[model samples]
Target: MNAPARLRMSRTALLPVLILVFCVVPLALASAWTLVLLLIPVAVAAWVLRVGVDIGDDGITARSLAGSRTVSWTELAGIRIDERNALWLVTTAGTEVRLPVVRTRDLPRLAALSGGRVDVPAPPAQ
Candidate 1:
C-alpha cells in the first residue's frame, strides 16, 4: 500500500496560538504560579501544531495532544461532518472519533485516502 496521507492544521491557524504564547511569556517569567499556568497555552500550541491524522489503505491514525489511535477501515461504521464542519469517524461499536485538524475542505483527500469508504459531502448550494 502507498504511504499514508497526513493532514495537519493550516499554518494560518497557528498565528493566534503563537501570539498567545508570546503574550504569556512575561507572565510565565513573573512567578512560579504563572509559570505553571503557562502549561495551558503550551498544551494548546502542541495540540494545534502537532496534532495530525494519517489515512492509509488499512486504517486511519489520529494523533492529538493525548496520543494516537488507529482504527481500521473495517471497524468504521461511517463518517459524517458535524455542524462545526469537523469530520468524525463512527466506529462499529458506535463510538464517535473526532478527527482533529480536519476541516470540511479536507474531506475529498480523506475520502480518497480511505479508498472511497468515506463519501465526500457535496458542497452547499449558494
Candidate 2:
C-alpha cells in the first residue's frame, strides 16, 4: 500500500466512560481534594485515544499513552499470542511489543499491510 494503515481502538467504548466522567463532576465540585478524581477519566480517555498500531513502509509502530516504539520489517521476528489473547510483535532481538487495538480478527489485514512479512494460516477444509 502506498499509504500507512492505521488501526485504533473504537471510540464507541468511550461513550460509557465519558458518561461516568460526568457523574464524577458533582463529587469533584463538592470538595477541593476530590477534584483530583477528574484525572482518572482524563487518563482513561487519553489512553483510548492514544493507543494504536500503525503499519507503514518502514515497519509497524506501537503507540501507547506515554510513548511509542517502531520495529522495522527486517527486525520483526514474528507475532505472539498470549494466554489472554493479546497480540504482541516479537522482534529479532527477542523483545516483544504489545500491539494495542489490534485483534486476532485483523490478522489478514495486518498480513496484507506487512507485505507478506507476517503470515496468516489458511483455514482448514470443511
Candidate 3:
C-alpha cells in the first residue's frame, strides 16, 4: 500500500506542556493563582496541537489552530530542523513555516522527502 501523507507535530505545543508540568504543577497544589496560570499553558497547548502540517501528493497543507493554509508543490522551497529541533517548511520566498510537531522517529521520512536536506539555512553572522 502507498504510505499515508506525512504529518509533523507542533513545536508550539511543547513549551506550554513543559511549563505546565514544571511551573504550574507545584503552584497548582498551593494556590488559586497557580490554577489560573494553568489556563494559559493549557490553552497554548490546545491551540498548537490542534494545528498540523500535511504533506501529500498535491502539496503541503498547514492548518493552524486558528486557520489553515495550502501551498502547492511548486511553491515548496525546502524543509529544515531548527536548533530548537522544530521542523520548518521553507517557501520559495524564504519564509519559514513551522510544522505542527516534530518527532525523532520521523526524521528519516522527512529527510527522504526533503532530499536528504532539512533546508536548515545557516545563521546570519552577527
Candidate 4:
C-alpha cells in the first residue's frame, strides 16, 4: 500500500541550479549577453525535474527530457545493475531502458512497487 513515487531526481537537486541562476542575475544586469548564461542552469534544472524513473503497480517508466518509455511487468525480462550502480530494465524484446536515479539500492523499492512481479533478495542476516 506504499504509493511511493520516487522521482528520478530529488527536488533538492535543483538547489544548486537555483543558486547558479540567482548568481547570474547580477551578471545579467551588467550585460545583456550574460543573460544567455542562464540557459545552462535553467536547462539543467528542467532536466532534473523532467528526467527520472516512475514505478507504478503496472509498469516502470523511464523518463527523459525528450520522451518516456513504459515497460509493463509482463514485458520485463530482468533487471540489470551496471558498474555505476545504475539500474536498467531489460525487456523480453532484448531492449534496455535505463532507470534514472534508480540504483541497485532501490531495487527493493521497485519490487514493492511491482507488487510481486519483481523480486529482490532478502538482506543477509547480520
Cα lDDT of all candidates, in order? Answer: 0.84, 0.90, 0.66, 0.84
lDDT of 3 by residue, 10-41 (tens): 47558758866687777776976657766767
Model 3 scores worst on lDDT over the 10 consecutive residues at 114-123
Model 3 spans > 4 angstroms off: 1-49, 103-105, 111-126
Relative to the true structure, candidate 1 reaches a TM of 0.79
Instruction: Extract clashing residue pairs from model 1.
Output: none
The number of the candidate with the highest lDDT is: 2
Count backbone overlaps in model 1. Answer: 0
Tell me the alpha-carbon RMSD of every candidate.
2.6, 1.9, 6.7, 3.0
What TM-scores do the predictions have? 0.79, 0.90, 0.51, 0.83
Residue ranges of candidate 4 with Cα displaced over 4 Å: 1-6, 122-126
Which residue runs of candidate 1 sit more than 4 Å off their true CA positions?
121-126
Best by TM-score: 2
Model 1 lDDT-worst window of ten: 36-45
**lDDT, candidate 4, 23-123, per-residue tens:** 88888778878778878888898899899887776688899989989998889999987899888899999999999878888888778777788888666
Cα lDDT for residue 108, candidate 4: 83
**How much lDDT does candidate 2 score?**
0.90
Residue-wise lDDT of candidate 1 within 15-119, one digit each (tens)? 887788888899899987788768877787777777989888879988888888888989998887899988888999989888988888887788877788888
Error (Å) of candidate 3 at residue 70 is: 2.4
* Candidate 2 lDDT tens digits, 1-126: 468788988999799779979999999999999999899889999998889999999999999999999999999999997887689999999999999888788889899888888998677789
